[model samples]
Target: MRYAYYPGCSLQASAKEYDLSLKAVCNRLDIELVELKDWNCCGATPAYTVDPLLAMGLSARNLALAEAEDLSVIVAPCPACYKNLRKAGKALEEDPELREKVNDMLTEHKLDSIPKVKLPLEVIASDFDWDALEVERPLAGLNVACYYGCPVARPKGGFDNREAPQAMHLLVEKLGGQPVPFAYDTKCCGGGIVFTRDEISLDLTAKLLTKAKAAGADCLSVMCPLCHLMLDAYQSQAVRRLDTRFDLPALYFTQLMGLALGLGREELGLERNMVAPFSLLERMGLKV
Candidate 1:
């Protein structure tokens, strides 16, 4: 199970734990992650808003680099990057004119070809040895609320189901953990507006957290760094602003999966997180 791994800028910097957890889990699962050489930013939301073609062109350049490595599938970690790459690939496949324009841009930039882009979660499930991923000491009593923010599984018909996607839920179940249903699983955390409208972002986050907590979710399992930031980092601020108390610990789906796979806490980079997971795991009777 060898594939090209693209750890976007955020994962390399603030989200280093994501990279560490992913590497550890992949190693344990016998999945080889070969990183693309000298990859650049995927031109997330900024480029798409300013110029769609430029965004596609930037994403296509990275795909071209992956093609140079003779890899068909690329595993992207960042949700924003995954959305950009997936959308660019879809746009190029659907619209021939856009494809030619992007290709022309690629030619101008001296990039050769484009390879298929895929999110790590989807790629792992689609093309991996599932039988080998059998659980050792599965999480029996843990309750997780699967949170997939706007970019990862939204705008409909990109990769998976948008409204009620069960990819993460299924993964949680595989670990013997129960995925609790909540109202705001697919709701936006006001990610793009976090910088500009802090109040609205915090309010939205607070609402989601409160709902998830009420729904009996001890921890919110996530896949996106941006969502993790808003839900975990801004949680205290959101609580302060709303004058409410919500101590929901947000864990990366991979991090929780790694723990279930019998990997030690250090391997999952649990210590690097802003939201302390020890109390949450202990509350669930999970040995941390």
Candidate 2:
């Protein structure tokens, strides 16, 4: 499968591992990703909240760029980017007024067509030939609590089931790992509230982590970098604030998949995460 890949702002900076691991996995899976040139941010939560048109305009510009490349499909690795882009494309695909307004904003890149925006997880789950896939090392006993994050299945009409998505579960099994079903798989992690409403965000994260820990998950396999920051980075602070002991490391699903594919830690940028995955994987009887 070939498509235009948009790494977004976070992937180029804080979430470089997502880019590396995703590209590596795509390569192994025979998926070609040609990056959309001069792409900009999809205007994530803040822009969408401030102005829906502004968000759609920004996301639409990227879609227009993909159209310039003669590409009809775009794969966004970030959940927020996927949501924003998919939302914009779907909106433009349906509403001509929004499409014209958005096309007007992008004088440089005209929207000749609205491309299909997709998440890597959905693409990989549906397209990748799991039966033909060969893993270097099987992750037999690793228990993973899949965290899809808020925007992933939100606004209710994306690709998969909003409330109870199983793409991650099936992917975990494909990697030879056990998927641990937990309560907060699709719960909100309190994005901006992390800084604005510290207590609320921390408490929410603590609650989610508590459930995953209770489920006997070795670590949480996540798709969104923001959720990784909240669940893995702020885990210690949340534990301290909640006065509870929850030691769970969160890794991108791609990182865990890379491990199962026998890729080295550094190659997948495993060390980029705030919560190091080495100890957790080591504890799972894997020689990390």
Candidate 3:
């Protein structure tokens, strides 16, 4: 169950909790994550916008590093990172000329082949045997709104369906938690332009929060770091902008999985969440 791991920029910083919970859950599952040496950023959202070639080169560098390790699969927790890496891998594999140009940019390393880019969600869904998993504290009463954001199921022909994905729902059911029907599950979080056009991002995030709350979701189960940032870190701004009272907590799916597996709060980095779930967990008779 070993795979080359890419934490990306967000996971190392603003989304550190995601990284922490992911490692904790993986450790429990006996999944070994061999992180790539000298791994760099995957260019995230802004790289391609500035220069398409540069974006490919940046992501390709990391792929080259992974290829050097001889690992066939590389898992990126951040959706943006996954999207960039996946795009770069596909481009480099399909277009030899483009790969050469990008290789020229990578003077120190050459990309003979690119590794398969997978999201952490994809890894958990495809690799693990759900029936064999031990759930010490089942999420019996919790209703989770599994938000995939945009990039996760996108660029098509991936693991889950582009329109109606069910991996998260199945995982929630497996953990004894109810997965609420969320129409905006694939909606854009406006994370790409969140910094430039904050108003648009806030409005979009507010809509998601309002919709999730209306659907009776106890909390949002998210997999993307940017989506989590928009939904959790900037939730207050969204609420204030909309003049609404949506105090929904946005949690990484790994965090919820850790809780179901009887992992401690601190172990999962639960305290780092902007909108704390302590009250919600306490209400559900779950330890905080």
Q: Among these predicted structures, which one has the highest lDDT?
A: 3
- Writing each residue's lDDT as its tens digit, candidate 2 over 1-288 gives 789999999899878988998888777778899998899988888998899888888999999899999999999988888878887888898999878888888888789788988888878877778887788888899988988877556756666788788888988998899998787899887755888889999888888888898898999998887887888778899888766675787888888888888887777888787877778777676655
The lDDT, on a scale of 0 to 1, for candidate 2 is 0.84
Residue runs of model 3 more than 4 Å from their true location after superposition: none
Per-model root-mean-square deviation over C-alphas: 2.2, 1.6, 1.4
Model 3, 1-288: lDDT tens digits are 889999998888999999999999999999989898989988776778899899999999999888888888999988778888988899899999999899999976799967998888888999888877899989999999999888655677689888898888999899989999899999998887898999998999999999999899999999988899999999999988876676799999999999999999988999999999999998887775
Among all windows of ten consecutive residues in candidate 3, which has the lowest summed lDDT? 149-158
Give the TM-scores of the predictions, in the order they appear: 0.91, 0.94, 0.96
Question: Candidate 2 — which residues are off by over 4 angstroms?
Answer: 49-51
Clashing pairs in 2: none
lDDT of each: 0.82, 0.84, 0.90
Best by the TM-score measure = 3
lDDT per residue (tens digit) for residues 33-64 in model 1: 89988888999888888987888888988887
Superior candidate under TM-score, 1 versus 3: 3
Q: Sort by lDDT, best first: what order?
A: 3, 2, 1
In candidate 1, where is summed lDDT lowest over 10 consecutive residues? 107-116
The residue pairs in collision within model 3 are none
